[model samples]
Target: MIVVGAGIAGVACAGELVRAGVPVEVRERGRVPGGRLASRRFDGRPTDTGAAYLTADDPDFTEVVEGWRAAGLVREWTDTFLAYGADGHREVSGPRRWAAPRGLRSLVEELARDLPVTVDRPVTSVRPGPVVDGRSCAAVALCVPGPQAAPLLDPALTAATRAVGEQRWSPSLATVLRFPSRRWADFRGAFVNDHPVLALVCDDGDRRGDDAPVLVAHTTPEFAAGHLAQPGAAGPPVEQAVRDLLGLPEPAELVHVHRWTYAKPTAGGVGTYHLDDEGIGLAGDAFGKPRVQSAWRSGRDLGRALAERLLTVGG
Candidate 1:
């Protein structure tokens, strides 16, 4: 079996398949795994520019999160955030959000530790026999965004791919800024509602459980779409918004912009996964809610179903 994506969903699926006694090979287009659970370093400090945090209400997922907490891979961030609007800002409470000391990507890396993942090797296409990039395989799982997976699927699975592609995905631009010191007010994070340029901002220092004076702000989907072709251009407006929101005196020491063309799915997909007799499967956050936990569950559920089918056929 070949899983073409090294994100959490892909890794989770491959992990389940391997545990089910199925041989699996993972492929990723990027240099590293984690996909949207992405993290990077700026001036020797790790920053989370992708998923802000993980929230769980489902019992099974909560169990997995508890395990991650026990292993010291994740920690409870906060259940409250400052909500901002034209009127003003106010504190709001919600479910517990989980964060990683090393970075969100590290969690996915840990899950993929035992899997054989080939990075920087993207699958060109998925043929009818579930062939992956011209290599014959019993099955192929495309664990990517709906729009991205649509093109890779063969004509025979057009109906499946079309349904998968129907889900709308919104783009986002994340702006990371490094301040000289912790001059901003004490707040773990803030949700900027009714803002034209900004949607949310996180105190990276607080979220990462470190006092690094770093901040990461995400642009609204509408704003991101306008500057998709030029991500860097979105940095200025985002920087201004951050400063205005936080009331910082000085400008950031360093700033960077990252674009996610398929940041999130607007609505849940048709099902947990799409699998046909041809052995081609589609699984990702698009299959459910646009969250890390949903992605994991989607891939895991699909893996179990596919494993059963393969085992029965082989028997």
Candidate 2:
């Protein structure tokens, strides 16, 4: 079996297949995996720009993340999260959120261990044996977004997937703030439900339990849309929006902006899809909803289904 996309869904799927005694190759378009839960280096420091944080309430998700935590790749974060609403700011308790020691992307990286993953290989198309470039495979699993998946499939499958549409992914603008000294914020993270400019302000440095000297602020969807049309628009307005959200008299030392065109899945079909004739399957967070836990479940269920099918085929 072959898997496209080395993100959470792809890695999880490939891991399942490999453990099931199936040979799998994971292909990724980017240099590294983790898709939206991405990380980058800034001023000699690394910070998480995608998938700021995630909480798991589902038992299945807990088991999967627990495996990751036991591997020393993930850890538990405090439950206290402050909410800055119209009334005022107050801390609240909720399910414990888990974070990777290095970054959320690290979890994906760890899961991909021992798996043969080829980076920088963009899957232009998928077909029966002997496609473009003379590549051949027995089975394929597509972990890309539904819209992107439509074009790569056979004509018959294309029509069925086209009904799913381009799948409008919610846009997001992340602004990272660098501070010389630690600025005290009640708790590690704050949620802004009814704010105009900022949506969430997070002390990722403290959240990671590292003295990384960094803070991150996210803009509301409306705010992100207003300026996302332009490529470089995330600079000034992002700074202004972060300042407004912080409700601070002064700005920080420096600010950085990251724009995600396909941030999260807004819509997907009824459930996951598998084409027996095509000898492949499809799964992603976009398969249902845009959450890490949802993605994990999607991959697990898809992997199980594919394993069952593969067994029947082999037998």
In lDDT terms, which candidate is top? 1
lDDT of 2 at 230: 70
lDDT of 1 by residue, 16-76 (tens): 8999999889999999999999999887777998999999987878898898899999999
lDDT of each: 0.89, 0.75
List the pairs of residues colliding in candidate 2.
Answer: none
- What digit string (tens of lDDT, one per residue) describes model 2 on residues 28-117? 989998887888777766688888877787798788788888888778877888888788888888878877768888888888878999
Worst 10 residues of 1 by lDDT: 158-167
Q: For residue 143, give model 1's deviation from the true position in Å.
A: 0.7
Q: Which residue pairs clash within candidate 1?
A: none
Model 1 TM-score is 0.98
Which portions of model 2 show Cα errors greater than 4 Å?
Answer: 128-134, 163-168, 229-231, 272-277
**Model 2 clashes, total count:** 0
Tell me the RMSD of model 2 versus the true structure. Answer: 2.6
